[model samples]
Target: MNTRDLLNRRAPVRRAPASNPAMFLFGALLCAAAVAVTYWAFVRTTTGQLADESAWREAEGAMPGTKLPVLQFLDSLPLLSLFIAGAVVLAVTIKRRRLAPAVIALGTFAAANVSSQLLKRFFFDRPDRGVVTLDFNSLPSGHTTLAASAAAVVFLLASPRWRPAVAAVGGSYAVLAGAATFINLWHRPADVVASFLVVGTWTLIGGLIMLRVTPDWNYWPPGGRGRGTAPVFAAMCWIPGLLALVISVGCYLYATKSMTALGSSEAMLLYFWSGLGLIIGVGYVLSALACWLFSIQAGDQDR
Candidate 1:
């Protein structure tokens, strides 16, 4: 075989996109920060000296609806769905001879689960007053962390053209799980926030590590097609944006109804809306940024 034939054969072997060392470093720092924050928060909550145990207790008391059926149903769905989806994604990717995403996805799940448990065990000694029955650690909600990590992994494997849509769906599911935990009084608001931080930090770290280690892996983004910015590309991007908007709005509305039903005062309602707005705004902006970055990177590769 001549040099030209060898070169032609090698051309089809896609180079893995360069992993940003900075991103990996940042991810490590963030993961450590999450651990520290979780530990501190857990200690505070458990010690009963942290900020307003009374407030947490009051919030727990304000939980609406009977816990017998609805809470059980919602709680079961998120974790189960997360596991099932992750398993399916893993299976399909492996069958297609794409191993990196599957491995990374599993690793991400494991990391999130471990971190969440550690936080829970460290922070919470017992359930709050409103919690009639107890099962797991309560500091950083396990369900929320699982949902967030699973959704993030799924988004990473999706086609750039389809990422927004998948992310929107996945994000909505995650939010729903968080809401269920909150409304059920299973965890405080801070616990949900910590869970997100932990999951996101680890997923970013795991993804960066996988990309760095397997520079030729084409498992993610499947088909190995370079990014593009063709006119049709705008439509593909918009689809996810639109989906995200819908989901965000839906979640906000649901949260509003739940809060109102629980008879939250006007001041508390305002705070809720403000917090919800911030989360949705940040999510949309980040989604847009991810799409833009993907387009630029893909376009350059295509060129």
Candidate 2:
């Protein structure tokens, strides 16, 4: 068959109009920032003092008063659950004739897993406490990352008609996973925050990639035209990107005890808010720029 005939036969084979190389580059830069943050939070904290001793004791004291089935489940199958969930999502997507979404979800899961492992290995050292701790590499909690990544992918693949509902479900899962990890004393609050950052950034990148592969899929706005330029695509991505940033900042502030503990001498409240404001501000500006650039490109193309 001629090239044109093959192209006609597989009309959906073309790269997603939304998957701009520039976006991929932007995503990479964000991932790098996440990695740096993870290193600083996990690695740097581990060095100063094996605070795990006090942290463990505190955890034990706190554990007696709490009943957490979800935490128990998380401790029992930290990494395993994510893989199983990813497989199930992939299977369901295939059955529904939405193989691309499934593939995108699974692929993102795999990439996140590998990245977590690499980070763990690079910063290998046994936890200063917790005899029952899984293995080396405490920074950027893998369990949390898996949960967030899977939840984000599920949100992306959900039908536009059901996107909000699906996003709610995914958000619930992500929260449960984070709580489970924290209550079980498996990961520090900072580790959980970093996980959200890294996994979330990658998930957005994956969604953008999927957009490129299927521009007509209308992954946003619940029933809008799929074939559009970068601006529309950027707008679709911006929602989740902003959400991720908001969640990350909230997690960081809460985990670091910056929001609570008012009227205390140790209140570095201003510092926390300042840092969070800067990150959020930069993220918003970048997203706006992406949208503007895409809009300009679309306009020029029309002309």
The best candidate in terms of TM-score: 1
lDDT, model 1, position 139: 62
Residue pairs that clash (backbone atoms under 3 angstroms), model 2? 16-212, 16-213
Query: After superposition, which runs of candidate 2 have C-alpha atoms over 4 Å from their true positions?
Result: 1-24, 45-57, 67-70, 76-92, 95-98, 123-136, 219-303
Compare the candidates by lDDT and give the number of the best one.
1
Residue 33 deviation, candidate 2, in Å?
0.8
Error of 2 at 140 (Å): 2.4
Worst 10 residues of 2 by lDDT: 294-303
**Count: clashes, candidate 2:** 2
Query: How many angstroms is residue 224 displaced in model 2 relative to the true structure, after the best TM-score fit?
Result: 4.5
Write candidate 2's Cα lDDT for 85-154 as tens digits.
Answer: 6666866677777777677867887787778767666754544432334455576678877776776666
Task: Report model 2's TM-score to 2 decimal places.
Answer: 0.57
Cα lDDT, model 2, residue 273: 32
- Predicted candidate 1 versus true structure: per-residue lDDT over 1-303, tens digit per residue: 998898767333333464565855665576568556654654344432122132244444344455555488565876686776677676659776777767776787788888788767774554453323343446677777777777767766665556546655665666666656655666654566567677666756765665566544422343434333322444443454456456545644564555533234333443333333323333333334444433333311221
